[model samples]
Target: MTTDAIASSFAQYVTESPTAFHAAAVARDQLVAAGFTELSELDAWPTEAGAYVVVRDGAVIAWRLPESATATTPFRILGAHTDSPGFRIKPNPGVRTGGWEQLNVEVYGGALLSTWFDRDLRIAGRVVDADGAVRLVSTDAVARIPNLAIHLDRGVNDGKEIDRQRHTLPVVGIDAAFGGTDVLDWLRGRVGEAVSWDLFLADTQAPARIGIDGAFLASGRMDNLTSVHAGLRGIIEAPADGDHVPVFAAFDHEEIGSSTPSGAGGPFLEDVLGRVQEGLGATRSEAARAFRASWLLSSDAGHLVHPNQPEKHDPTNRPRPGAGPLLKISANQRYMTEAKGEAVWAAACDAAGVTWQPFVNVNTIPGGSTIGPIAATRLGIPTIDIGVGLLSMHSVRELVHVDDLAALHGAVAAFLAG
Candidate 1:
């Protein structure tokens, strides 16, 4: 696909996926459109050659098995996370103070708190009603966290600290009756019924093509969503007739250490892969052998060289947007990309006619982790951490070179097809 086409599709994915559950739903739709059958975890497996998808809450695993596939066929898993840093509404969120109504929120991860102030924000997530039906809701901007004016805090120009509990509450309205059931009432109105659910606050602004010539993409949820979309598109577009089985796995809750039932640290991936192997009549030893030959690409967003703060990145391994997909590495094993894994990614890049750059955090600065290390350790599979370089990660909105997405798409497709 052209760079514009790739960027446009990614923007659409980001716009539609404000939460992990929604992202998995969108991935499910894409896989179904590509003729993949949905499988329930409780169902018995069929020993057949077909494309199938298994879902667990906000996580999804889609794979294509050819007729020639056997118990010992190696699996090529493309990994990405569906979650991002944001604010989730508290179960009892409504509060009244000074005659104004606000919602209590809990911070989900390491979010840039300052960027959230004075922006149009909306609530989106899955809502389960009284009758046990789940509904996805993405409402327009109905709340905002107004920052303290400069007149009230003259020291604001200087770096200011924000208390997560006290300072970040978003003001919803001036109604004093909004204390008890106000937030839920508003959501129920939008959902067309009374329902109990979990909700997250998101920026209402749509994704946009920025820069002078529309060279950059500015959007929220790009950190991992970019990888999610790229991997989904790559897996769908890759040739599926190869001996190695191709799998697309996107897990939720990576932003918060991936410890949930559907997170990478859980049994979702292992269970599905085990089922695939078992269906093929593989012994445990043979399955281990297959894992030894298997490889995974844990795709997430990497940091681009920031012009305003270049000192934060490693001087020797600075990554730039449009250079290519960034191969993330760390001596501390924060990233799963070791020398052998690097070699596999390099070959994929060469096959796809794409160049690549390396990303390493400066010695003084610590870096974050991804599902790469978690799944690699869990499954004992050789894995490399890969991503497109972007700026303002975890902020209300992030930026990435438009063409970088296309390069990432090419590299992932080549890796899956290789």
Candidate 2:
């Protein structure tokens, strides 16, 4: 449990994960390499205590089985999403103008669009070929989405919203980048040759430690990727304790209300949980009861109090970088926790030597939400939402405390073991 090792691992995760599919693939390989068996959502599961992985669409869920199981030993589940808000490519997205090549992209989530400009942008995602095999594709160099010149859009300095559908598309090629009909072919070549796939622009920058004390992590997609990596680690590091079964699930489409088949709003989890129970020889009624008795932690990144705008946060409940994991609370119930649920997880933080903070967004302005209450209500399980505090959430490059990486992993890993 060395900090340097965890920092290295966090940096590794940042480099490999530019898309949900790639992130899931990275975690899948790690779980498999760590001796976790892969499970198919379309197939029957083995009837033993072992590690398992499940993927539906781009979403993933992995876990370590308790040595033995009874109907009463409720499963301890940790939930995280792999999707982040970014520019997603559309059907026939190519467009050429002013000797520049670019692809039309739609912002997928509540992204901080301002930060995306003038940064290196590359593409990464799963390529589903005509023959039905899926291959991961990526472009790491010159991976930036260039912004409009300040001179061209002087009004940008004032108040104006850049229409995502019209403006803000990344310039992908050099001058004359979109010269001919071969643009699609060129893209296919850059990714995987002859591969028909969905690709989105991603920053090619690697995650690294920043600042004087080496206290910050400047990385892209830290919002849920951080949780995905930590959840993956927790699932991998779950102890051999015979008391609880630890489960980790990372779903896609969370950035867009999670309404798709692979999202938390769908049956991917329900289907897998049913199989998990059946594999352990539990009847349907027993499975239902077990789910009712279980508890879940919906792990996503929370907002650190912004240095420039500290007034935006609740004075007493604000979470700071390096302080530890944040307890996300919303009076609107955007998060899943109540007082008792928070207490249950806060105790885990206490045991892991991980400090905790509270997040109740400022009044009336409204705030973003997570997959916590979504899954809890769907499965009727007690759930709490918590995460590491970060600044510049949903930005191309986000920041957080270097030590909070290990602190979060340690907390989630410890909670799973419990």
Candidate 3:
């Protein structure tokens, strides 16, 4: 893809995807338009070059494999999550108090409470209709979640604890008469259509270059969504050389744990790999061998050094924004890079002439989890996870380097091309 095209595509992804399903749909559209073959879970995909398939609504795993290879041949896989931590619409989610009724929401994952304050919030997600057809929708043109006044919550500065079930439920309206059903009707009309589907409240912010030197990117849901875009593009752009399968997986439920069908811990990856082998007329044992020789790059976000909390990061391992991709390591296996895996990644970076750094948290505060270990265990393949280092992770507005955006594209493209 050209630079102009990449920018436009990234803009569309940043604006359209507020949930995992929508992200997968958007990516599938792009890949499909590029003449890539689409596969489905209901049917087996032919094991050949240039074939791509999406699984579930929240995840997509596409590949271009060698036609003659048995299941014992190793596969190259890139994994990224499509979901973001935000407020989900509850079944009964309306409340009226103090002449202001709001849409009560459940927090999906870990979110930085303070970053959400005083920012424009919107609702966007996939809505399944009665006919079982899923349509993607968005509220980018309006504000749905607004912060409470500082005067009302003086303790906010003294470390106010935000109850995900209560205080954090976004105030959707200032009038009781305009609550509940009215809000749903308004949402249905906003899309210029009527639909009943899963909806998630989110921030409708665009990711862009910031700072005088174009050093930063301020955006919403950059954690996994950024990786989602990169992986999709990588798969689409990778050359269709025979026998070198290019696979992509956009998983859901990563913010929590991966037990669902769309999660990393479930049948998504395994089922797809098995199908690929079977479609190629290989035996089950051959499929196991092919998977064992494979490599899965679990793409997720890493924490960058915070300017305000310099003391909280390790002195040498602090990952800087705009440097390059971050090689995340945790003693507890929050990341899944083994010694051989690291060597493979290091060699990849060296071949591409791209700079890289190690990321580790200060000993006191443990890091969060990614889909790394799950992919490794399921495939029994060596795995290495890398991502753009970020600040204000899980925040409504996360910070990254704009250069890092292009850097990620280049790195991922190089990885796929190899």
Candidate 4:
């Protein structure tokens, strides 16, 4: 697809995916529409060469098996996460403070909290009804965390320090009845009475192309959703004739260290790979061999050299948006990329005729971690960390160059093909 086409599709994907659950469900639907069969964890999987996808809660894994594949055939995997840093709804969320009805929320991850202020927010996530069935639900624009007026705090321009507990509550409506709005009741009205829920606050704004000449894309969840969409597109377009298995695994909870069942730090990927190997009639030893021969491309969004804060980035290894995707590296294993992994990525980019830039944090600034090291530790698979470069990462809205996004898709496709 052309770069414009890729950007347009990505915008649509982001608009549809308001939460991790929505992201997984949207990917499942897309995969099914692309002629891939959806598999259940409870049912036995087919070993024959074909395309298959399986979703586990907020995580989704899909793979293509070649006709020449065997029990010991290695896998070429592209890994990403579905979750982004934001606020999650707290239980008994309704609050009537003074004359305003608000919703209580807990900070979920390392969010740029100030960016969330005054934005149209929606309630989105999975809700479990009394029948124990889970349903994905999302609300229209219904809330906002309005910032304090400048007249109220003249020093706000100096530097505003947001209080998470005192200032982050999102105002949903007015308490005209002198009682709470009963947010739960409102939710039940929309999605039935739910016994429990795992809901989050999401930005209701649509993703769009911005900047002069439409050089950039702005959207929520671009930190990792960009990688997720790239992997999705790559796997769907990958040829099934390759010698190795091609897998796309997008897990949840990476923003919070990825320890949950559906996170990369858990056994989801290993379980699916084992099941696939078992279906292929592989012995325990053969499965181990297959894992040893496998490679994982851990794709997460990385930071570009900030035009205003250039000192925060590595002077020599500075990466920029629109140039290409990033090969992330860190001295402390925050990223899993190594010499061998670098060579593999170089080869993949070369094969795809795509350019790539290196990314490393400045010596004085500590770098955040990704699922690359965690997944590598869990599965013992050789993993390389890569992603598209973005600015305003972790903000309510993030920015990425359209060229880099398209190049990331091509590089992921090439990696999976190998």
Candidate 5:
């Protein structure tokens, strides 16, 4: 597909995915539409060559098996996360102070809290009803966290510290009569007696192309969603005749250190891979050998050299947007990329005719890590970290080059094709 077409489709995907649950569900629907059969964890899987997908809560894993595949055939996996940094609604979320009703929320991850001020925000996530049914729920713009007036705090132009507990509550409504309103009641009205929920607050703005000649794309949750979309497109467009199995695994809770059941640090990927090997009639030793031969491309967003804060990036190996995707490196094992893994990614990019650059942090400023090291430790598979460059990575709205976004899809497709 053309770069413009890819950008357009990605914008729609980001708009439709406000929470991790929505992201997983959207990916499942797209895979099913592409002739991939959905599987249940309790049911027996087919060993014959075909396309299959399975979803576990907010995580989804899909794979395509080749006709030449065997019990010991290796896998080429592309990994990413579905969750982003934001605020999650607390239980008994309704709060009233001086006649104003607000929603109590807890900070979920490392968020740029200032950007969330005065934005149109909505609540989105999964809800469990009394009948033991799980339903996805998304609401319109119904709440906002308005910033203090400049006149009231003239020093706000300087570096002002924000209190997560006292300053981050979002106003949702006001008491209309003697009785007060509860946010849970409003949610129950929509989803029918929701007994429990895993809801989060998200920006309601649509993703769009901005900057000169539409050179840039801006959207929320692009930190990892960009990689998720690239992997989805890569697996769908890859040839079915490759020698190895191609797998796409997007897990949740990466923002909070991926320790949950559906996170990369958990056993979700290992369990599925073991079951797949079992379906292929593999012995225990053969399964171990297959894992040893497998490779994982841990795809996540990387930082670009900021025009204003150039000193924060490595001077010699500075990466920029629109040039290409990034191959992240860290000497402290923060990233899983090594000499052998670098060669594997270089070959993939060369085979796809795509350009890429190296990304490293400055000596003074340490960079954040991705799911690469965690997954590598868990599965003991050779892994490499790679992604598109972006600015404002953890903000409510993030920015990325349109060309880099499309090139990432090509590189991931090449990697998945082995």
Candidate 6:
């Protein structure tokens, strides 16, 4: 596909992926259409050379194997997360105050609570029924978190603190007698037969190409979905036959420290890699050797120096949108990028003819971590952190340059191909 087509495809993918479960499902469809066989973790894996995908609840691992590949062959792995920061619906979330029906919710990650105010919101997530059947549910815009009037809180001009339980509640409807059809009742209708569900509030706005020249793309979930899309595109564009086994892993639960079964900090990737080695006819010792030789490119979003707040970023390492992807580094090892990892990314960029930049947080300000450090520690692999520079991260919506996204895609494809 052309570069313009790639950007448009990515926007559509972001719009369709409201939850991690939905994102994984969309990726699975794409892999299957590309002739990848879906394998079961319970069943024995195939020992032949081909394309295959393995899926857990919300995580997916896809790879391509060459016929000549063996136990000792090194693997090229690209990693990203599927989940983003938002509001999650509680189990018993119904509340009626002052003749208005509201839904109680908690912050999922480090969300910008203020941006969520005065925005139309929808619901989407996995719902489980009494019969133990799981169903994915999405609804039209049904809630709004209207901000308080300036007259009511005149201190709004100053810094205003948001109380999670009080200020973040979204009003669904205004009803004095909210007896019959509450939030759960409405959810049941959409879920068909669901008894309970883990629902998340999502922005109803669609992704769009913004800016005067349309150089900027604005959308929700760009914090990490951009990396996820880039990784998948790289794998698809890569040659089927290569010296190393090319793997793409889109894990879930990174925003929350990645401690779950499908998270990067868990055993999911390790198990899948072990199975791949065994399927490729490797012994335990050879598998260990292969892992030592393998490398991981942990892709996520990095913060660019804000135009108005330049002091927030490191003076020497200022990343800007539209330049290129950044090699994220941290003195505290928040990112897994080391000297070897930096060389790996630099070579990839040079081969792809893409300009790359460096990113480091300010001395006094510590930045958030991604799946890079977590996965690197868990697998003991040489890993580098790379991402497109973003603005207004963890907000209801985020921004990125179209050129940066293209650069990221090119760099990742080159890395996987090499």
lDDT, each prediction: 0.89, 0.81, 0.75, 0.93, 0.92, 0.89
| Per-candidate clash tally | 0, 6, 6, 0, 0, 0
**lDDT leaderboard ranking:** 4, 5, 6, 1, 2, 3
Runs in model 2 deviating more than 4 A are: 142-144, 174-181, 191-195
RMSD of 2: 1.9
Task: Give the per-residue Cα lDDT of candidate 2 at 410.
Answer: 82
lDDT of 3: 0.75
User: Higher-TM-score candidate among 1 and 3?
Assistant: 1
Show the lowest summed lDDT stretch of 10 residues, model 1: 175-184
Off by over 4 Å in 6: 176-180
Tens-place lDDT digits, model 5, residues 203-320: 9999989997999999999989999999999888877888788999999999999999999999999998988888888998898888889999999999999999999999899898
lDDT of 5 at 401: 95
Q: Comparing 2 and 4 by TM-score, which wins?
A: 4
Candidate with the larger lDDT of 4 and 5: 4
Candidate 1 structure lDDT: 0.89
Q: List the residue pairs that clash in candidate 6.
A: none
Better of 1 and 2 by lDDT: 1
Preferred candidate (lDDT higher): 5 or 6: 5
- Against the true structure, whose lDDT is highest? 4
